[model samples]
Target: MRVIAAKEFSDRIRNRWVLAVAAVFAVFALAISYFGGAQQGAVGVQGMEVTIASLVSLVIYLIPLIALMLGFDAVVGERERGSLDLLLSMPLTRFELLLGKFLGLSAALAASTLAGFGLAGAMLVMQWPEGSLWHYAGFMLSALLMGMAFLSMAVAVSVVVADRARASGLAIALWFFFVLVYDLTLLGILVVSEGRLDLDFFPLLLLANPADVFRILNIFSLEEVKTLYGLATVIPEAYTSPWLLAGIMVLWMILPLSLAAWKFK
Candidate 1:
């Protein structure tokens, strides 16, 4: 598993895909960090709290898309190339192969996320006040977890689907559901009901979507960010604990990977 993971990681690095992703992340992070408050009529660098709130929106949209794209073809590509059978014919078990692939892809994702956001983080550290860095760190951590969750789902899709084309299509559909349609559907429900939906049950609905979980986790972590994102009025204080949301993100990663492992075996 270690050998496979190392080879896969090295291959992505050698192919320059990892570097390209990191560069993209760095550029976006910097732009959002510096210019996020322009809509609020603020000039110059925004506060760490406000910048983090802005980046959370960007992260929610971008990270999961990148993750799904990266992992959707992991297994199908191997199968298409006739390498999966050869790899399974070796000493490794199917579980080991899947595990190694996940680890490798995860490592690549993590490296890109850290390097790209780390550049922005470094700039924030230099310019922003010292106390709010932890909030930004929490945002980065949650972003990484969100990426891993989607990556796991993509891998599961690859394992269950017959070909890369189907997996690719499923990947896009998953992105649309989670990133776009899910929230819209929820909003539609709320609107159709004329705001009569119970606030208590609404959080459970938010918890169902990993993207919303990511948003709630970061938004509620800091009071300032919560206000900036206007989540203070909607999300209850009781449900905003960092540890609980983090656990849900973990479950999101585990459940999909478990399904993939079962199907692969």
Candidate 2:
């Protein structure tokens, strides 16, 4: 597992995938943080809450797509290349191999996210000394967890699908559902129900998607800015705790990967 993990990480580093992703994230983070309020005829570091809110929107759209694209081919590509059998013939279980692949890819994604966002955060902090340091750190961590959860789902798709083409399609479909369609669908339901449905139960539907969990985690942490943010505005009091939402995020990380491992075996 260690050997496989190291090779996977080193391969990403060698191919400059890490650098490319980090550059993309850093560019977007800086751009959003600095120019997000341009429509209001202002430019520069806004308040920490504002900057983080902007970046959260950016991450919700970008990170899951990147993570899914990155790992969608992990297992299927190996199978297509006829290397999966050879690897399985080695002294390792399928689960171990999958674990290594996930860990290595996850590390690459995490490093890129931190480096990119951390750079933007540092710049903002320098400009706005009053910003909450831990708040930005939490935002970055939640972003990383969201990336990992999607990556896990991508790997699961890689294992279940017959080829790379199907994996790619399924991964994108998952992204569209979770990032774009899920909330809209829920809102549609609410509209159709016309307040007849119990509103308090709405937050439960959010747990099914890691992205929604992330929104809740970050938005609620910045309590003062919750109503002013996008995506998730009114989480139930029970679901507002960051730790509980984070635990759900962890479950999101595990369940898909666990399914993949089961299918792989």
Candidate number with greatest lDDT: 2
Q: Whole-model Cα lDDT per candidate?
A: 0.87, 0.88
Q: Where does candidate 2 stray beyond 4 Å?
A: 230-233
* Cα misplacement distance, residue 44 of candidate 1 (Å): 2.1
Instruction: List, residue by residue over 1-265, the lDDT tens digit for candidate 2.
Output: 9888888889899999999999988898788887988999998768788888888888999999999998999999999999999999999999999989999999999889999888877887776656478899999999999999999999999999999999999999999999999999998998999989987778889877899888888888786678776434446678777788888888988999999999998
Pick the TM-score winner. Answer: 2
Residues 111-158, model 1: lDDT tens digits: 888888888788777888776778777878899999999999998998
- Quote the positional error of residue 177 for candidate 1 in Å: 0.2
The alpha-carbon lDDT assigned to residue 105 of candidate 2 equals 95
